[model samples]
Target chain A: MSDEVVTPLSHEECWQMLREEEFGRLAFRLVDEVHITPVNYAVDHDTLLFRTAAGNKLLSVAMGAEVAFEIDRYDDHHARSVVVRGGARILHEDEEHRADNVPLRPWVGTPKYNVVEITPRVVTGRAFRLTRPWLHLTLDGLGQE
Target chain B: MSDEVVTPLSHEECWQMLREEEFGRLAFRLVDEVHITPVNYAVDHDTLLFRTAAGNKLLSVAMGAEVAFEIDRYDDHHARSVVVRGGARILHEDEEHRADNVPLRPWVGTPKYNVVEITPRVVTGRAFRLTRPWLHLTLDGLGQE
Candidate 1:
């Protein structure tokens, strides 16, 4: 049997997955290092919107750094992942009013007044079938006896 | 009731979560931009180990770039996240032999001959209670009648 179980996801499928999931990890460059944090987001008109407090995440967007956002789901049989690479910008003045309708909510009680939008430059994803090595070993041993 | 529901996880709790989860996202800098990809990993000693092919991830390790690895879990009521920030190095020669005992296998069928280890400089995490805004709004509307 061929061992290659990975399948590439199409553009439409990628956007659909992004719409279905509300939580994801946001990765951004901070000087010489990279940082990743989990954020709850909403997909709106081909863009991703998330709210954050005034922190390093907000600082990175203020600096206009390119960021990557990813979401994935997996079970015992299969796994899928989607990644969006884009430029992040904080909403300002009139734009902030537009974001008010996106239905985004922060999980914590802390005030997250900063609403950031990620305009994706490239979106990519893959799906792969999972293999349980220890389970396979046990089955193989049983068959050998 | 206070809206703030996030609680900081102890260092011990962070490592415990890391040991329990098999998959996480690895974020690293590639030139001017940052990238994040899902990976299956193993917790060996105080470090994290994963296998990868000769790709951007391996190249980043060769460049001695600092990276971030994150794993999280959430349910209807709560969410927990852990992030590890540190330098990644590709295990070589004798070190590769040591990594052979880590029990990490690739989800894909492709050959992944390179083994990389992340020695973390800082490990931080948080646990937060989730709020379902739509559900709460629906209940509030029902009571308004």
Candidate 2:
């Protein structure tokens, strides 16, 4: 058996994963504290687009703080995660119209009028095989059964 | 039907959800940038515990940075998210023994010697109904047949 359990994902694979998944967690700095919130996002070209209400997320973008967005999926045997670190900014006027072209929508019924974009500076990901120590052994799988 | 679609989770409920889940994203600051990474964790009393190799996550704990950890689950109809904000620190010497009592384990085959604890200052959560615009209507539901 191969001893390698973790492998690095390529840039193309990272973007493909981002494009396929609509939900992810967004991490941003608000003053000295770091906050992570789940968000629904869409991949637009090389940037990520999402809508938000007027709150700390918008405030953080206004303050020009760096943000990290992550998405992952795991089954019983394997897992993959992609992280994007970048500067977030709120879209305005014509940019808001551009955002409308994407399929992004608020998950809740609340009105989230502010559209934000994340321009990634660093994108990295990893795929790893999980070790299931609790897997049950079955006699049927053996020749004795 | 009532128009209320989003509801806040009680403190007890938040803790219950945290206790039930073993995987979540941990967000912390390194310098001015915020980073998010998925981790497998276990709830130990009022704190959260997980093991990691020597890396940026451990470095953030050593620097006494406030971290945000989040876990969420969503289906086609509903979604629930819980966020925990706390200060993370590395467990040393005998403290590592306490972590061993928990079910926490590294997902990969590599060895993770350092155990870290997150002492939460604020824990909050919300449950919301999802608006699935893509749901197809069936005549059977209307009793047309």
Candidate 3:
């Protein structure tokens, strides 16, 4: 009903927001179809790390699937969104030791031994806020004029 | 940190959650790349309706792209996620008038004259909650036993 402004967030702002959010949606292809799943993750510098067990998600990662990860916060008056797109890979046996220190946790008690990471090839974000008009005129006054 | 349970919501339950949530993420492939964007949308019975102007979002829909729309709610102890994979199509000129009746509204003040619809071909959802083990034991007592 009111006017609004949509601003493109800077690269630094995008990363900042991504780091703050602990949960996001991961999208990848599975069984010749596109699937998106919400994942609890940790930000490891520029890449994202999440744990998943033997499921469609893990299978996709094994297939070298390109993925898109998105996280955002929204309220009645404002919304901020960030999207990270890149290839996802499972951490190798040697890299698993470092992942143990990353603090990634799964909501369910499902033992997520498979640690997957998405190295962002492209990152972008945008923010939207509502604004009000400076002058408020009565509908009756406008009609008379 | 504790035991948890993962429950599979039925089809009816999934639809109910979809209707209650007003915001979601839309995933589509563009230029051999997977891209996901947060969108404010309204559920139209078994389908999804959202408006977008002349942008990549609209272009992807115009090209008859298969898209994935995801909406979820999560907390520290629980998470519910629903994924809808379907084919997207722009509403025809003759059908534009009916689009006005839809509750879909864009957050920004952008003139989203293009009304796109995704008729879901597959809809699935799952929920996870925390649970505690029946025999909770102290760290020292467990080893002694």
> What lDDT does the true structure give each of the candidates?
0.79, 0.79, 0.71
DockQ of each: 0.39, 0.39, 0.26
Candidate 3 CAPRI classification by DockQ: acceptable
- List CA RMSD, all candidates: 6.9, 7.1, 10.2
Which residue window of length 10 is worst by lDDT in model 2 chain A? A136-145
Q: Model 1 chain B, TM?
A: 0.84
What is candidate 3's lDDT per residue for B1-145, written digit by digit as tens? 2243777778998897777776789887665566788877777868888777756554554347688999887644566888898898877878766555655566567655677888998889887884323113222211100
Instruction: Mark the 10 consecutive residues where model 3 chain A has the least summed lDDT.
Output: A136-145
Model 2 Cα lDDT, one tens digit per residue, A1-145: 2457888989999998887777899988887888888988888999999877767544544346789999988866788899999988887767887676666777788865677899999999998888756334322211110
Cα shift from native, residue B72, model 2 (Å)? 0.6
What C-alpha lDDT, on a 0 to 100 scale, does residue B143 get in candidate 1?
A: 18
Which parts of model 1 are misplaced by more than 4 Å? A1-3, A55-63, A135-145, B1-4, B55-63, B135-145
**Candidates arranged by TM-score, highest first:** 2, 1, 3
DockQ of candidate 2 compared with the true complex? 0.39
